[model samples]
Target: MNRYDNERLSAIAVLESLRAGVPTRASTKALPDLRPNLLEIFKEDLKIFAGGQNLPGKFVWGKYGQGKTHVLASIEHLALDMGFAVSRVSLSREVSCHNLFHFYSKVAVPLRTPNSTVFGLQRLINQKTEYELLNSPIQNEGRYVHPLPALIFEDYFRTEGEEQDTLYGYLMGNPPSDFKSLHKKARGEKPILKLERKFKPSEHATAF
Candidate 1:
């Protein structure tokens, strides 16, 4: 279909989402801005983040039934359109951000990039070579306090099927398993993975 056709369909979808009281990316994008100043602030933050600078976290506070979630949905769509990955999650009894790794797990699995409908970064990671990953910013630039995540990420590329799935799940804050055994399955001939340091839950909460 043409560009106009796509926009027309998206508009319809946005209307439906709004009608249901569920604000989505499409609705966020097509509708008129409710708070342009706040949006500009978020846009500037996103621009800086895209430039590889660390941005302090933002808090959105509101009373019940306010449009806080709706604003976040708008930001999600805006970030996606800017070629940034987005993950929008809600807190509930089952999910709490009090535990950093637990929060990481919740966000990691739902990762959404600008170009793909599929969730997670597996496809993107699968496209990279060892050399590329080894020298990548997350690994070499001191993004995380612990190397465990980068190591598991490296191994994720090495293994296949269930092993790979497990590694991905491990990153997503699932229960720990015999990673050594799992690594052996992936790299039988290679030496077992070694930790440069122990992973302490309290200290390593922000590793994601």
Candidate 2:
């Protein structure tokens, strides 16, 4: 197929996947050029993130059919290209903003990275070194202690055996009730329960 035809087919496939309630593999290439203003804003925000600066969250607000999802997918693709991990979650009744635990779980479930488009968190946990993973938390305890992302990292690296399964269960909204029990089962006494228990139920319920 010609380039245009190929792009058309790719867009169709993405729409089909969305209709099927499956994750779409849409990339920035599939999207038309964003408006110049939007593009500039995206670049500026991306530069901040790439520079290791904390940028406040930007919300995309539009009615249905205004290309919100497409814009988000494009941003996600660009973030991955820029070596940043991305996760996209659509809020529904089941994963509502009113319910923090469910929302957090949904966000973790769809995390994507440059290499892995789905289940990227698992890949990250397995690939990142213990020192690499623990360095920031060790250096700056305030930033990484009780945040949702920190909880995820702590739970995944809490014990050695079946780490992936434990994280998967947490992302799936079925966190362990007791980290002490989990550590005992793994035959490791690392003392993560205190930190784990410090999190609010909305924060650590899935992985606690």
Predicted model with the maximum TM-score: 1
> How do all models score by TM-score?
0.81, 0.64
Task: Estimate the lDDT of model 1.
Answer: 0.81
Relative to the true structure, candidate 1 reaches a TM of 0.81
Which candidate has the highest lDDT of all?
Answer: 1
Worst lDDT run of 10 residues, candidate 2, spans 187-196
- CA lDDT, every model vs. true structure: 0.81, 0.63
Off by over 4 Å in 2: 1-27, 30-34, 61-64, 129-139, 146-164, 171-174, 188-198, 202-208
lDDT of each residue in 131-192, candidate 2, tens digit only: 67556553354543445445455556656657647755764565667645664544455554
Instruction: Evaluate residue 10 in candidate 2 and report its C-alpha lDDT on the 0 to 100 scale.
Output: 80
